[model samples]
Target: MTQHRIRNKNLGLAELIAIALGGMVGGGIFTILGISVSMIGSLTPIAIVIGGLIAALAAYSYVKLGLYYRDEGATYSFFKKIYPNSHFSASAIGWFIIFGYISTLALYAYTFSSYAISSTDFANNIWIRKGIAIAVIGVFTLINIWSVNGMGKIEDLMVYTKLVVLTIISVVLMQHGTSSFGTFIDNMALDAEKSNIFSVLIVASLTFVAYEGFQLIINAVNEMTNPEKNIPRAIYSAISLAILIYVVISLGALFAIPTEEIIKNKEYALASGAGNVLGKLGTNLVILGAILATSSAISGTIFGASRQMSVIASDGYFPHWLAIRKNNSPQNAIVGMAVMASVLILIGGLELILEFGSITFLLVSLLMAVANFKIRDKTASSTFLTALSIVCLGIGAILILYYEFTTKWEQMMAIIILYLILAVGAWVYSKKNEMKGKSS
Candidate 1:
C-alpha cells in the first residue's frame, strides 16, 4: 500500500465553518442581492432559497468526496483518484479552481474599496478607493503569509459579524414592515406574461454566486481535526446557515426597497435596504459589514489557493519552489497568488472579475460532481446519492453557462483568456523543471 504522508491536522469544525461562511458571504451578497431582486422582482427571497438548495446539493457531494479522499488537493486529488492517469485533466480542473479563488480575491479586494468609501466620508475619490483596495490586499496578504490559523480566526469573527448584522437589519425591517407578507408572496409567483422561465433561470444563475463559498470547507479537510466526520458536519452546517441568512437578507431587501430602485442602483442595494429601516446609520453598518465580509473572503481564498498551488507543485506539475512552505505555510504561493490577484484587480474591474470567478467556480463544481459519480463504485457510498450529485452539478453548470452567455459574455471571455495564458505558462514551466531535473 502506498503511504499518503501529507499531514492531516490543523483545522477543527469551527475553522471549517469559518472558511465555508467566509467564502460564501463575501461582497457578492451585498452587491448581487439588489441586482438579483431587479431581475427576479419580488421572487428574490425564493430565488435565494433555490440557489441555496442547489448549493446544498453540491455541498453534499463534496462531503462524500472529502470523507472518502483525505488529500490536500481536495477537488483535484478527488478527481485524479477517481480517474487514474488523468493528471492533465486533474490539473486542468485544478487550474479552474485556482482561477476562481484568485478572481474572487480580486473581486472582494475591489469591493473592499467601494465599501470603505461608502462606510466613511472618504471623498468618493477613485484613486483613494484604489489605494485603499491595494492597502487592504497588502495587509491581508501579510496576514495569510504569517499564519493560516490567524486567518481562520479572523474569518470566524467576520462570519458571525455578518450574520448578526444582517439578522438585526432583517428584524428591524420586519418591525417596520412594507407591503404585507401576502403581497410579497403573491409577487413571488412568476408571471409568464412578463418573464419567461428561461429569463428567471438566467437571473437565478447569477444569484448562485451568493452561495459559492460553501465548498471551501472541502478544501480545508486536510486541516480538520477529524476530517472524516467533522468535514461532513461542517459542510452541512455551514451551508444550511448560509442559506437561512441569504433568504432572510434577500427578503428584507425586497421588502424594504422598491424593485425599480434596486434595478436602477444595483451596486449599493443592500445599503439602500438597510437605510430604509435603520436610516443612514444602518447603511453605514451594512457597508462596514460588506467590507468585513469581502476582506474575510479574500483572506480565506488566498490561503486555500496557495495550498492548492502547493499541491500542484508537489505533484511535479509545476515548479518545486511553489511547494516550499515556511513555518508550515506556503508563503511563496500565497504571495504569488496575491500578486496575481492584485494585477487582476487593477486590470479587469470588480464586476468582470466576479462574473469570471462565478463561471469558473460553476464549472469546477460540476466537474467535482461528475468525478463523484465516477468514483461511487470505488468509494463507500450509495449509487443513488452519487448519481443525484452528478445531476445537480450538471444542472448548475448549465444554468451558470446560460447566465454567462446572456449577460456576462465579456467577463467570461476575459476569464477564458486568463486560463489560456495560465495553461501555456504551466506547460512551459513544467518542461523547464523537467529539463533541470534531468540535468541535475
Candidate 2:
C-alpha cells in the first residue's frame, strides 16, 4: 500500500509580506541613499520612485512564473524547467543567481557593520567594519542552519519592527527639520534642471538592486498557505510598501539633512544625518532601525538563497556536498554562502560590490523577464507587460554597463573577469553532470 503525506500550512499573507519586505528593505535604502544623492541630489526620491517602478515590472514576471510553477527553487528551477534540454542554461543561471545572492549577502552585511559601528569610537576603521560584517554573517548562518521556523519568526519580528521604527524616524526627521521645505523643493528643481535625464535613468537602473529580494516569497511556496493568491499579494504589497517607505525616508532626509552631509557619510548617512539634526535620541533610533533592517536581511537572504543553492546542487550544477541537509535545512549551503560573502567583504570595495550586485541582479531579472515572455501564455502573464519588462530591463542593463564603462572601466573589467570565471565553473559542472548522466 502507498501512503499519503500532509504538510504544514501555517504561513499566511502577513508572514509572506514579511519575507518579501525583509528581503527588499534591508541595507538597500541605507546603502543607496548616499550614492543616489551624490548622483542626483534632491531628485534622489524621483529616481527611487522610478527604481521602484522597475522593480514592479520585474516583479510581474516573477509573480506569474511563481504561480505557474510554484517552485521553491525560484530562478534556477524556473529556467531549468523551461529549458530542460540545456545543461548550460541550468548551470549558468545557477551560478549567476547564486552569486547574485552572494553579492546581496555581502551588501547587507557590509551595511550592517557600517551602521553597527557608526556611533562607536571606531566608526571609520575599515578593517573593523569588515570584521564585524563577517561576524554577523557567521551569526546569521548559524541561525539559518539551526531552524527554519525560528528564522521565520525572527524575520517577522525584525522586519515589522524595523518598518515601524523607520516610519517614526522619517516623521521625526520631517518634524525637526533643519532645512526649509521650500529650499528642499527648490534644490530638487535645480538638481533636476542641471542633471541629464540619462543620468537619472542610470541611477534608477542601478538602484534596482535595492529591490532585489521580492522574489524570495516564491522561495517559500512550500511553507506558505494558498500560494496562488498569497504570492501575488505578498510580493505586490511588499513592493508597494517598500516604495512608499523609501520615498518618505528620502523626502525626510532631503528636508532635514544637508545633501553634502548625506553624501559625505554615505556608509552611515541616515544615522549621521539624524545625529546632526535630531541629536543623540534621533541617531540612536536610526541606528536601531538599521541594525534590525540588516539583521532581518541577512537572515532572510541565507534562508532563501541556501534553499536555491541546495536545489541546484542536487541537480549536480553545484558541489554535491552543498546538497547535504540537517533537519530538512540546507545547512552546508548556508554555511558555504556565508563564508563566500565574508570573503567578498574582505577583498571587495563598497562601490565595486554595490555596482556588481546591481548589475548582476538587473541582468538576472532581465533574463527572468525574457524567460517569462517566452512562456507568457502558459504563465498567464500579459505579453505586453512582459515585453515591456524585457525592454526596460534591457535598457537598464545597457545603461548601467555604459555608465560603468565610461566612468569605472576598471570595475567593469573586474566584473567581466568574474563572469568569465563563473562561466568556466558552470561549464565544467555542466559537462561533469552530462558525463555522469551518460554513464548512468
Candidate 3:
C-alpha cells in the first residue's frame, strides 16, 4: 500500500473567495465607471448588473470545468486536455489567454499609476506615471516569486481591506449626494428612452472585462482544498459580491456626481466626484480604494497568470525558460510578464489596453463555455445553462467587435493584427511540438 498526502493546502473558503474577488475587483470598476456612465447614463447600474449576469454565465462553465479537471494551468490546461490531438487549439488558447493576462496586467498597473499620482503635482506627467506603474509591477512580482503562502495572505489582506475602504467611500458618497433617489430613477427613465437596447447590451459586453479576474481562483487549484465544493462557492460568491459592489458604487457615483464631470474626468471619476461632494477627505478615500483595488489586482494577476504561463511553457507552448520553477513558484515567468506589462505602461493609451484586455478575455471565456457544453454530462453541468452561457458569451463577443468596428476601426485593426501575430506564434510552436513528437 502507498500513502498519499496533500501538503500545504493552506487556502480555505475565505482565501479562495478573496482570490476571486481580488482578481475581479481590481482596476475594472474604476476604469469602467466613467465609460459605463458616459455610454449608459443613469442606466450605468443596470448595465453593470447585466454585465455581472453575463459574468455569472461565463463563470458557470469555468466552475464546472475547473472542478472536473482541477488543473492549475486553468484555461489552457482545460482546453489542451479536452482536445489533446488538436495542437492548434491548445496553442491558440495558450497565446490568447497569456496575452490576455498581459493586457490585464498592464491595465491594472496603469490604473494603479493613474490613481496613485492623481493627487500629486506630477499627475499629468506621463513619464512619472509610467515609472510608478513599472515599480508597482516589480514589487508585486517579487512578492509572488518569494512565497505562495506569503502571496495568499497578502492577497487576502488587500482584498478585504479594499472592500472595507470601498464600502466606506460608497456610504460617504451617498450620504453627501446632491441628487435624490427619486430624481435618479426619473433620470434613468429619461435616459432609457433615448438609449437603444443594443447600445446598452454593448456597454454590458464591454463590462465583461471588469469581471475578468474570478478565473484566477481556478489558477490556484493546486494550493486549494476540496475543489468540488470550494471552486463553485468561491467563484459564484465572488461574482455576486462583485455585482453588488459595482452596482452600489455606480449608484453612489450617479447620485452624487454630475454626468459631464464624470465624462470629463473619466480616468479618476470617483476621486474627482468625491472631491466635489465630500471635499479632500472624500477624494482621498476614493483614491485609497482605487489604489488598493489596482494593487491587489496586479498582485493577483501576476500570481495566477505566471503559473499558467509556466505550465504552457513546460508543455512546449511557450519559451522553455519560462517553465522554470523554484520552490513551487514560477519566478522567471512572473518577471517576464511584469517586464512586458511595464513596457505596455510606457506605451500609454490606457483605454486601448482596457478594451483589448476585455475583448481577449471575453473571447476566451466564450471558448471555455463551449468546451464545458461539450462535456456537460461529465462535469454535471446543466445542459440548458451551459447552452445559455455559450449564447450569452457569443453575443457579448460580437457586440464588442461591432462596437469597436463602428467606433474605433483603427484600434480594432490593431487588435486584429495582434491576434494574427499570436496565431502565427502558436502555429510555429505547435508545429515544432508536432514534428518533435513524430520524430520521437
Q: Point to the candidate with the largest lDDT.
A: 3
Better of 1 and 3 by TM-score: 3
What TM-score number comes out for model 2?
0.95
What candidate 1 gets wrong by more than 4 Å, as runs, is: 1-10, 119-123, 190-193, 429-440
Which run of 10 residues does model 2 get worst, by summed lDDT? 1-10
Record all residue pairs in model 3 with backbone atoms less than 3 Å apart, i.e. clashing.
Answer: none
lDDT of 2 at 375: 92
Per-residue lDDT of candidate 3, residues 1-440 (tens digit): 01111575767788888878888898778667888777879998889999999999999999988989888899999999888999988999998899888988888887788889888899999888889999999999989877777888998898999898888777777878888888988999999998989879999998888898899998888778888789999999999999999888888888888898887877577888788887999888888888888889898889889989999999998999999987677898999999989888887776776677888899999999999888899999999999999999999999999989999999988888888999999999999999989999
- Give me the displacement of residue 424 in model 3, in angstroms: 1.1
Estimated TM-score per prediction?
0.91, 0.95, 0.97
Q: For model 3, state the Cα shift of residue 145 in Å.
A: 1.3
Q: How high is the lDDT of residue 137 in model 3?
A: 93
lDDT of 1 at 203: 56
Candidate 2, residues 166-264, lDDT tens digits: the string is 898887788787877788878878998999899899889878888888988888777778887999999999999999999888887887788888888
Rate residue 232 of model 2 by lDDT.
91
Which of candidates 2 and 3 reaches a greater lDDT? 3
